[model samples]
Target: MPERELTFAQAVREALAEEMRRDSHVCIFGEDVAEAGTPFKVLSGLVEEFGGDRVVDTPISEAGFTGVAVGAAMTGMRPVVDIMFGDFLTLTMDQMVNQAAKVHYMSGGHWKVPMVMRTTLGATRRSAAQHSQSLHAWFSHVPGLKVVLPSTPYDAKGLLKTAIRDENPVVFFEDKMMYKLKGPVPEEEYTIPLGVAEVKREGDDITIVATSSMVQVGLGAATLLEKEGISAEVIDPRTTWPLDDKTLIESAKKTSRVIVLDEGYGRYGVTAELAAVIAEGAFYDLDAPVKRMGAMHVPIPFSPPLEDVTVATEETVFEAARQLCGKT
Candidate 1:
């Protein structure tokens, strides 16, 4: 269990490197992954180790390359497909939803797709609407797809390894805000199992369920709530698709109230999903109705101040929690 401090991007690169070295079937294909090594340097030096044939640099055709990756996965290759930005996933939705996700299930579980779809998300750099978005919600809504978001270096490495080896097509989201944040990650290899929720903080007053970048914001808000004598429990649903509703429901039953914070839009996004699930599973334990806070349903703005308002943050989480606890 030896550990080293590394940024989120470095952790992702390490996971890919380790997987590629261990399995010959593991190949990476993405635009600029070979030469430019990705905008966040997540694939830096991978081409040198795995060579150009394995670390392929595809054209800008997301649809074509994604479909190609799906076909490769079906035939026994474990391809780590990288979409430059989560926003561009829309172009390959048909291939991902109809093909990659559904193929194995449609085939009566006889076939398995061990493919990982890696993409960068969030708007910390002000990349605007086209390049910046938290679209895990989209992938989560589709059945047969696994969605994962790692907020720390350790989880980033372990979850990516799990996604690479998983039997189903997984959409792995790396929040741009976490790319530079450093944390303790193991030197030896490890994999975090999917369909699990990690309770980062435990408390009895209120429960905060967050995903992706909002995990950090929820933690920050939890600290402030602690000072005000409001104990806050924070839960990160690391994998969104097969969400660990049992853990969340148990926590909510103890606390009797829940607030869901998400980086995606408020309407029909990750937050919406959590709220719906809690309402369904833990309705009797509620002191008040479940609450959700997230970015407005509009496109991400460019200005820093505007972006601050558009995305969920500590203020938003605090207000939502306060309202749920009857302290607002």
Candidate 2:
């Protein structure tokens, strides 16, 4: 059978639709989600299939609906709240960090908050600073929350299903710029467990550990490195919180050099944590200090030129890896 292909948005919609059909408890809450299917239209036609009650359209209040979703999850419904923009995540931090994250722990494992928050990250849509930010690191820092960043259609669908079924709260981050990216997705049911890393490309020269959207950039950089007689391994830690440190450590051990990449800010970000993990695990077997590449430490710009420089690109990763391997 020919492998079926789906865009990232289609994969997300399929994941939600499948989960909703399989479990009545799974529902969505977001502005215009019921009728408009969100600005991205990832949820189009879902209300027709599941009805308005389950595919709820909320007011223009991120905090209000997020709080409601938390309560709903505590009561037994598996609520998937949608924050239209990732920058707006600041509005839902309290609910996510204090209430949802500590519920089971405070209750001594007596209560479970089976909730999921889906939001978009990445720039270049001219959405400006208020709408563009990759804030997954904040949620990952918390003890109980699971942070998922799916880079491709397959990972998006599979990771989402797993997040929806998880007993604890999960924050799913999607690259808004990649909703239309095409990739192969199987028609059969599948779920990718949180905290596991997948090596997109295997090599012996260096390891590039990338998260979320940076995975694609890392792969491109690997291709460039390969042409220069430099081998690069690319690993994607699909989820940030329950991170797969072992796989990352082993990759670093094999390659001896590593570069950590993400779309978030470089200072005290996911890249730092990943680099620390690699250093801690494979310190004895070393070639160079793990380099970190990420978004510039500033509010995302609306200008094409300014915004272009802020994000990590294939060329940037390639240069960083080449320099790390002493090729440049």
Candidate 3:
């Protein structure tokens, strides 16, 4: 029998549905999340299955609803707040950073904020600056929050399940452009633990450490590099906060050359932190300094051609890796 496949959106929906069925506390809160199924239609039919009480929709108030979700989680509810766009995370910073993140710690470990906030990231969607920001690194910087970046449909399903059941606050960022991207997923219920890194491809010449949407970018670059006799390893740090630094450092040690790729800005971004980690962990073993590639540090443009150049691509990564490996 052929392995079943699911799009990234479908996988997310399945995870939410299964969790809701298993636990009545697992509810959804966001704008148009109930009947409209969200802007991307990823939540279609969920409200019907779970009903309005569970898959509840609220007014277009991110800060307001996020505060409600935090309170709900603290009071024995596993609430999932959908923030639509990752850029809107700014509005909920106080609730997330000041409240939800510190509730358990401030309460001497008595209070728990088991909440999940789902949002979309990535550029090149033509959504312009306001809607097209990849800001996962912002949440990763917070100590009490777990930041999840699922690169594939399988990862999307498993990691989401884990996030919903986590004991701490979890911020889940999805690439809006990848909702329809398809990949094999198991029918059995399973959850991928946070903080684990998956080595998608193995190689000896160089290591490409990528997160979220950039995982595919790294894979594509690996394929291109293969033709040039450059064996590039691709590793996906599924969660940025509880990052699998050991795996990333080991890969850097083996390859001796490293490239950290992400959709966020390079400076003070996920790419910079990962590069630093690899440099610190594997400095003696490395042959070259770690390289960082990310979105251009500018407001993502509305123009198609200009926006396309802001983020890393397979060709760009291929060229960078080739040069780092002295292929040129």
Best by lDDT: 3
Model 1: how far residue 209 lies from native, Å: 0.3
- Lowest lDDT 10-residue stretch of candidate 1: 311-320
lDDT of each: 0.90, 0.94, 0.96
Question: How do the residues 262-309 of candidate 2 rate in per-residue lDDT, one tens digit apiece?
Answer: 999999999999999999999988799999998999999999899889
How far residue 203's Cα lies from its native spot in candidate 2, in Å, is 0.7
What's the residue-level lDDT of 173 in candidate 2?
A: 98
Question: For residue 170, what is the lDDT in candidate 2?
Answer: 96
**lDDT by residue for model 1 (207-259), tens:** 99988888899999999899888999999989997889999999999999899
Sequence-dependent TM-score of model 2: 0.99
| All candidates: TM-score | 0.97, 0.99, 0.99
Better model by lDDT: candidate 1 vs candidate 3: 3
Off by over 4 Å in 2: none
Model 1: per-residue Cα lDDT at residue 171: 94
Put down candidate 3 lDDT per residue, 226-282, tens digits, no spaces: 999989999999999899999999999999999999999998999999999999999
